[model samples]
Target: MDSEKAVPGDGVVVRAIRAGEWGQARRLRLEALRDPVAELAFLESYEAAAAKPDAHWREWTAGAAEGTRDRQQFIAETAGGEWVGSVTVLLERAGTVDPFGGTVACDQGHVVGVFVGPAYRGDGAGVTRALFDAALEWAWAADVERVRLYVHERNTRAEAFYRKAGFVASGVRATGPAGVGGFELEYEMKRSA
Candidate 1:
């Protein structure tokens, strides 16, 4: 599914990231990690991501770009070709273990790495909405029964956006690891299809 926002003149189009565009993906990810809210919004640190080698990015993009069933990343870009935002979805199957060390009891899509540039935030543009719509549509197309995402309790902006997008709290809470600072509350959101 195409990830074009309905509002014209925004010049932002969301689409599946290409494997060869790993450089663009890496740049956007590094920028996301540098956001002021990165500590609460992402699990990885900018230093850690920046330390990774180019080979790592190549492999990362190959696995998450379009055509990969286990994972996919959608990028929001401008007409002039700047990547302004991105979101990735990971397929979790029944009985498998997730990154947070939780058991997946059903076929679902796990949303992660959600971000929009500071200059492009808010509803007036819809860049974030377009990226999310693409991710959810991709998951549903793969017969995923549900789509889930975890947000830090401190990230009210993301939580509010998820709520607006039809993702309800699943009443699940988990303690984050040392990588995410000590003992942060993580809330789970499930798409209400």
Candidate 2:
């Protein structure tokens, strides 16, 4: 399905991720994870993400796009069809436990793995805003009451962007594993009536 949003720059398209775009997704993901600030945003290392098998990529992309019972992924592509950014929203089920240690409430959606290529960043192409809009629309369509994302405490740029997109900090902090030595800041955006 093509859900287009008005981005600041010309010829930008925001839509659901394609089914067989695993190769492209994998490539873009690696590029994003290689960014200087990646350590604060993404959990997987470039080595780990790059080493995944084709089957893994296929499953990851497919599951992320169409979404399973739990997760969904979306992409923002330029008019020329280059992927400029991406976002994934994971649904937390009621009565079920989450890996982040919160009992699921109101079928919340957790946004993660958000990244925009450096060339596209700060250009106000609307890639980041478009991605968030699309993800929240999907979550609300799926009957989720609210959407949330965890930003690393050090990732001020991402926090600023999220704030611009109408997300407010819930004042919740979660610590990463010892080696990472960072705290995650949780931000949430609620579905509008």
lDDT of 1 by residue, 33-148 (tens): 99998998888899999999999999999999878899999998898999999999999998999877888888889899999999888888788888888998999888877888
Model 2: per-residue Cα lDDT at residue 93: 70
In candidate 1, stretches whose alpha carbon ends up further than 4 angstroms from where it belongs are 3-7, 177-193
**How big is the positional error of residue 92 in model 2, measured in Å on the Cα after superposition?**
1.2
Candidate lDDT (C-alpha), each: 0.84, 0.82
Of candidate 2, the 10-residue stretch with the lowest lDDT total is: 1-10
Candidate 1 yields a Cα-based lDDT of 0.84
Where model 2 places Cα greater than 4 Å from the true spot, the runs are 6-8, 67-69
Least accurate 10 contiguous residues by lDDT in model 1 = 182-191
lDDT of 1 at 173: 71
Error of 2 at 126 (Å): 1.1
Q: Please name the candidate that would achieve the greatest lDDT relative to the true structure.
A: 1
Candidate 2 per-residue lDDT, tens place, 32-121, comes to 899998888998899999889999999888887754556778887787888888898888877788767777777788898999887767
